[model samples]
Target: MNHNYKGFFSIVLLAWVDADYKFMWIDVGGLGSQSDAQIYNQLELKECLEDGSIGLPPPSPLPNDDQDFPYFLLGDDAFGLRAYLMKPCSGRTLTREELIANYRISRARRVVENAFGILAHRWRVLLSTMQQMPLTVQVIIESCVCLHNFIRIRNPAIQNIQLDNEDGAHNHVPGLWRQDDNLQDVDMPKEGNRDTVAATRQRDYLKYYFNSPVGLVPWHDRMVGV
Candidate 1:
């Protein structure tokens, strides 16, 4: 497993969250040696998605559009681009429309990012290495996730303040988590099969859709500065 700059062993936590910032699924205890893609490929969730047993919503066309698009997860460039997973276009010479689409995807991805932020903020133990057995550390992580979900569901108003908010002008207001030390992000290498022809086509369609009248948000062009 890979160690940190401090030469300490670490584990990667893979999480999937909903729009409400609740953990829908998670995989913990991935050795620091493995890349994000490697750990992701081993997930049963990936198999379920492939076998159509994950109960994902059926593909539907965007508003006022006829081409159907699947509900996909937003990921960063470290992940492989698939029909069920969308990532930003790589390279600097992107078209204006592509940049706008990327911005929209990023905006949506903040929910998942915020989820992790809240997790580390609430359970500060995750901010530091737990010098416990691997099995025990896994239990601690899982227990924190369960408690987070419980608090979020049983009493959402309390967590509302913990999350980032948006102002009337649509600018992001940093959450309480950002005020103090937070979790560190892993710098995973890009996967070998990062893109496929079908995936590229799907992403292209999304780019076009986001630029269309129905998909364009009022602030998108301004945000992208295009």
Candidate 2:
């Protein structure tokens, strides 16, 4: 988050679990413009659920050093790991079964990308407004999320089929939203391609998080809901 560029935006990821599907982890992530600089401005969504910003649990061999606790751990990948950092496997290596389980878990994290797709095409925030002031940008981003979550939850009441395979895999069921052909402009990234390194890294980091032990429940069985 301390990084600087011509303009800056901090990424915020809202991930969850879905128990009924084959892949149960769903990650919904995005960038926060300026309104997110202070803690208060983020209070509404801060309490939304587990944000991975917290430091790791007390280390093994329990050190007396006060600074050992995690702090200032920025980035969306960090936040997404908060939920996966579950019990009993914090410092342990995963078994083969666990590895397969994690591979599936990693697949589920694509929900974040899908969510962004909806936001970009339907909401217009990511498509345009490329020049808003920092604070104003933040406000708009927050507003979109408020509206995003509202629509996401409320849609269930009327019976909808927008999200397919909430079981968490990178899947496309006929009843749900289809992959946008335009997405190919950015997705299906070419390996070793420098032009899209950032996107590639983001995908890798997401994979790394799912494959590692950073959640409270540990990547055990697919829960269908995060």
Top candidate by lDDT: 1
The TM-score that candidate 2 achieves is 0.40
**Model 2: lDDT to the true structure:** 0.39
As for candidate 1, its clashing pairs are 1-33, 2-32, 2-33
TM-score of each: 0.91, 0.40
lDDT of 1 by residue, 136-204 (tens): 898999999999999889988877787788787676798777676445553345565558788899999
lDDT of each: 0.83, 0.39
Off by over 4 Å in 1: 2-6, 184-192
Name the 10 consecutive residues with the lowest summed lDDT in model 1: 181-190
